[model samples]
Target: MDPVTSGILVVIVLLVLMAIGTPIAFALGAVSLGALVLDQGMGELTFFGETFFGHVSSFGFVAIPMFILMGAAVASSPTGRDLYRSLDIWMGRLPGGLAISNIAACSIFAALSGSSPATSAAIGKLGIPEMRKRGYPDGVAAGCIAAGGTLGILIPPSVTMIVYGISTETSIGRLFIAGALPGLMLAGLFMVWTLLACKLAGGYNSPNPVAQAAAQIKENVEGNVKALIRVLPFLLVVLGILFALYGGVATPSEAAGVGAFLCLALAIVVYRMWQTKPIANIMRDALRESVMIMLIIATAEIFAFALSSLFITQTVAGAIADMEVNRWVLMGVINIFLLVAGFFLPPVAVIVMAAPILLPIIVAADFDPYWFAVILTINLEIGLITPPVGLNLFIIKGIAPDIALRDILVGSLPYALCMILGIVLLCFFPEIALWLPDLIMGTGS
Candidate 1:
């Protein structure tokens, strides 16, 4: 069969399996296995074990579970509440301050957790109710949390970036640094829109009387101090890990190990979670999520191998390359494809399956792979809040069951636009994404 026919059949079978409730890992594995058997006959099954194991046996992949454990530790504790409280105390008086605080909290938590759903669930649990209490519109309240959570994949220690780096042989450190600036830019955009939205909605809260404000500040002084102290250790750990990674003090796996240990220790000491149940819950959550992601990575490797064996990878890349299209136009098409893929697949799956195929095309177009990583991430971020499989949107709904799904979707739309604007700005000023990585790591090329 022609590569095009085979590619379509593979996609159709995979999608049908997924639509009928097959797990992504299984569907990917099944399609790849079937394709290989058909293309190469039964002899291929003899080496399937080796091929599958080889895909996930990388030492760098260890960073995934360790980072996930770090996130799980932080998520299982009261750290999210403390971070929100700290930001709230400082920013809560500004117009739409509560919502802004939520976005800030999400950005910080995104750095800590490196998982969007965890960031959303942790911050949303506290921020959503608090925003609702403060007379913030439900749409604004839900929108900020949902949108802010997408920052997880764009920030350092990001599992998605790790997967992309591993898939494409890009430097993980450069990928992390590449995302730092763009992530902050996107967060700033979220905050800017939030401030404007609140103002346009006649403000989320009325101004407090001078005397009442002073009294409220005095009352919360001790608690705020305690909250800041509680939140400081986690921030320090995250910063330390980033420094280790960027400063060449440790490999990604090594930094992740130390970060995971420190985060778990802090969780135990600060939250008094020494009990078996809490500790076990953290491990269980980390293990479950880690296994899910690793399985997808392994299966995606198989899928990619199948595509290569079928000549689809080369065929498609050659077809696109032969078009001689404008680089930006090619990028626009790639972004659309990624956005659609992301609507159904998680970030890791999309990165592992698509990055290998896209990276060469992007580099052939004279684009920096690291910068494109940020762009690809922002595209996927939009999908996290989009429909059918918008994980963050569902997380918001679960957090605030009474909030209409329509309201959550409506609220998240503006933030999605903010991400698109972020992409546009990055395109016009590639330095926005490239400058940091270049400054620190000296141009990844």
Candidate 2:
């Protein structure tokens, strides 16, 4: 059979499996294996095993679990609660203060967690209730948390970036730095939109809920100084990761190791969480998440191997290169496709599946790889809040059972729009995502 025809069959089979609710890793692997059988006979099955193992064997892949462990440590301990409390104390008095603080807390937590659902769960648990109690609309509060949680992958130490960097052979450290500016920019945009929403609605303070929330705020204010003191170590962990990665002091993997250790130490020593069960639970949860992610990556590698062997990736890139359409127009079309795909696929699945085909075309278009990474990251950020399969949306729903899923989805729209706006800005300016990485590491590094 012709290679293109064979490639088409593989994609069709993959989709059929996915549509029936097969896990992404299994779908990818099964399709790749079937394709191998058609093209090279059953003897090629051994290659699949080797490919999967070799892909996961990378030293760089170590960062994923380490970052995950760090997040888990924070989650399983009191540190996460303290960080949220600190932000609530400091920012809760502003217009849409609770929601704004939710964004702030998400950004800080994203630095540690590197996973969207985790960020959403950590903040949504505390933020949604407090905002609702304070007379903030349920949709608005839930939406803010859902949208803010996307920062987990957009910010530095992002697991998605690590997967992108490793899969594409881009510099992981530079990718981490590239994300910092855009991540913070999007967070700011979310905050600005949130504040505007509050002001236009005559402030988030509902008459009855305001009185109720006022009392709660007053009670927390007396201990604000103490809360700030408790959150210092978490602040340092964020700073330390940035310094280690961008300052040329350590590679991303090494930085992840350090961050994970710091989180563990803080939980056990400072928080005095000496209980064995918490530690055990943290390890178990982190291991489960890490294994799931690694499996997706390994399967994606097998799929990419199959595509490369079929020359599908090169053929597709060549076809795009020959197209008469403007590169920017082509990029916009690709972004639209990714945005839609995000509704059905997780970020890792999207990155693994699409990056191989689209990345070559992007590089050939003279688009800076770093800038495109940010653009793609922002697209994934929007996907986190989109409906049907948005992980963040589901996370909020899970945490706030009383809130309607429609309300959560509705609330996330503005922040999603902000992310879309951020993408456009990056496309036109390109400098926003590059400046920090360039300043710290220079363009070549």
Candidate 3:
């Protein structure tokens, strides 16, 4: 069979496996291996062990667990709660203030922890009940967290970027820097949508008219100052990491290590919950989370290797490049395909499976790969809020079980549209993603 035909069959089989509830890692590795064995017999199987082990054996990949540890450690502490409370007191006066604050907290937490589910769970646990208590609509409250959570990977120090970089041999550092402006841009878009949604929906519901009036009046006097003081340390740590990485003072791994240690130390000192057992438990959670991700990554390596050896990836890219369609139209079509695929797979799986096939086509069309990364990341962001496999939707459901999954999904639609707008913005102004990396790292692609 032609490589294109074989590649198409492999994808169909992989999707069937996923639809039938196979784990992504397993489906990916299984389909790849099946193709290999069919093409060249069991002797070709020896490549699997080396590829799987070697892919995970990178110093660059070290940043993934380190960043996850940092996030888990912070989540185990009071930082998330404190950050929310701080933003809440200040942002809580706006239309849908609590919801706005939820997005703000998620963005900040995204900076602190580069994992979407962690961002959602940590902020959702704090934001949801409070919003519900404030009479914010359940769907609105849940949706905001669900949407905001997607920022975790678009922000710097992102684990998704790490995996993409490792897979594509893109400079991880530049990818990290490239994400900053776009991440902030998406966060801004979410906030705008929240404000507009709440306004149209009759705004935030206050618990007590008299108390709210009194609190707002007091907030006029001293709240901002107090909130600033309360949040400064946490903000400083997040800023310090960004400054280190963006300033070229540290590699991503070193930066992650520093951020993890610093955040852990801050968590202990400020929360003052440095008991032996609690600390041990915090580390244990981080280890558990890290191990789970590492396993998926290890198996994904097998899939990546099989795709490369079979030339399926390059063949698909070449075919797409050879198409007579306008390049921008092709980009749009490719994005649509990604959006559909994202409904069934997690962000990591989408990137691992598609980047190899689509990236070269993107480059061939003269789209900046760095800029394309931002656009692709936005697609992944939408995936996090999308249904069936929308990781953030399920995350919010897990955190706020009473909020129906349908409500969360419905609420996320606007924000998902906002993310689509962000993608359009990147498509028009690739410089939004390129400028920061070029300024900081001096451009290479």
For model 1, the superposed segments whose C-alpha errors exceed 4 Å read: 206-215
RMSD of 2: 2.5
Worst 10 residues of 3 by lDDT: 205-214
Of 1 and 3, the candidate ahead on TM-score is: 1
Tell me the tens digit of each residue's lDDT in model 1 across 139-167.
Answer: 99999999999999999889999999989
The local lDDT score (0 to 100) that residue 364 gets in candidate 1 is 90
Q: What pairs collide in candidate 3?
A: none
The list of candidate 3 runs beyond 4 A from truth reads: 205-231, 443-445
Against the hidden true structure, what lDDT does model 2 obtain?
0.83
Q: Per-prediction TM-score, please?
A: 0.97, 0.93, 0.92
Error of 3 at 187 (Å): 1.3
Candidates sorted on TM-score, descending: 1, 2, 3
Expressed as tens digits, the lDDT of each residue in 1-445 for candidate 2 is 6667876777778778988989888888888887777778888987777898998999999999999998898777765577777777677667888789889989988887888888889888888888888788887899889988999998987999998998788988788888988899999999999999899877964233245577765667656557667768866896898888778788888989999999888879877888898889889989999999989888988887888888786776676778889988889888988898787777887888788678888988889888888888888888888866788888888899889998888889989999989998898888888888888888778
lDDT of 3 at 64: 82
| Candidate 1 vs 2: which has more lDDT | 1
TM-score of 1: 0.97
Comparing 1 and 2 on TM-score, the stronger one: 1
Clashing pairs in 2: none
